[model samples]
Target: MSHPLVIAYHLVWTVYGSWLPNDPRGSGSRTVRFDPLADLGDIHLGRKRVQPPRREVREFYDHAADLLKHPVLDLDKAARAIVGAALGEVVAAERYTCYACAVMPDHVHLLVRKHRHTAEEMVTTLAAASRAGLVEAGCRDPAHPTWTAGVGWRGFLEHPEDVRRTIGYIERNPLSLRLPVQRWPFVVPYDDWPLHAGHSPNSPYVKRLRAAGRYP
Candidate 1:
């Protein structure tokens, strides 16, 4: 059966002060911010949501830029295009089957199969390729870092349903923000997975997944 993956990463620009390690929602690391919420005691309650400290919201905004190595990144059309192209090249070179991707102005979402590389390696390579592409396009500043210091968020997709849901979410993210639909040349057809109507399903990849009972 094809391994499913759903990887979501926010750019350094998007996370600046909005969602720091100190966020009351819980943090990924201590270096990002001094999370006072971590001091409040056990916040994990199974699947329940943890509320952030109301005061730290303002604190995060105050020190957002100070925490970043570069100024906030607001990608223009050219920048997004460069990153998208670079992402496609990396995917093809790595031999991972890409299902969906959304290269938002400040972040990116990807749904792919875990192939020869681990998810962490995939994301790191993608970040590096994207940075190089930005540099080539003259969109990246030489004086500052292109991406955030640490690796962005990573999650595993355990089921075909998860894969389908995640892809839909990624595809519809721009619309959810009231932005225009994101169409890019790098978005390859995901023949291995179930697609909305009108997409052909005549690939060997789809046949394998179907034989494995991974897709309907």
Candidate 2:
């Protein structure tokens, strides 16, 4: 049998202007806008940097708040549902396996297997679909974007343990935040994943992946 070409990714993205580039609490150089006084260190395009310090990060947020076009994102229930459905549709249409996802008020977490697309491409497509859904649902204004410009954070899940840990994190994010358990229609179980039982044992996708030993 041909080895499965399963590649997994754990992705994180924030709402527009929610987590700024100059955020003191550690930020990426790509997210920072042009600023005269910004003390940018280890300048690398689209890479995360260790935050300067908690006090410094807080100060930056305090000062930068006035310059923000929008306040911190806190999506309502309707908006969350719209975005979740949109993400699910994108996954299905792209033939990607979505292991888990969480749509938080300010950001989102997704664990998906890459197929016929790069991680960046998947993030961009998902963001675009979500923005359109939000606008169509009247959850967001068409004139304003709902997501940050670039992909926020992405890490490859090269090992089965990594995939398992990420899936746990995505599933438990809401509970960790002291919020109600998140349940969305988009989350699908992988039959080959021994860590989690498959929801549909007879599903063709599950069977194919299982037969090919593509659990991770």
Assess every candidate by TM-score.
0.68, 0.75
TM-score of 1: 0.68
* lDDT for each residue of candidate 2 in 1-216, tens digit (9 for 90 to 100): 644334588888988866676554546654345464255322344434553666876676666656667554567778888899999899889988888899998899999876678888999999999989999987778888788778779888654566878888888998877878887776777443423454565555445556777543
Q: Candidate 1: deviation at residue 184, Å?
A: 3.2
Q: Model 1, range 183-203, lDDT digits (tens) per residue?
A: 765566654334446545555
- Candidate 2 wrongly placed segments (more than 4 Å): 1-6, 36-59, 70-72, 192-216
- Pick the TM-score winner: 2
Could you report the Cα RMSD, in angstroms, for every candidate shown? 6.2, 6.0
lDDT of 2 at 190: 48
Colliding pairs, model 1: none
Of candidate 2, the 10-residue stretch with the lowest lDDT total is 40-49
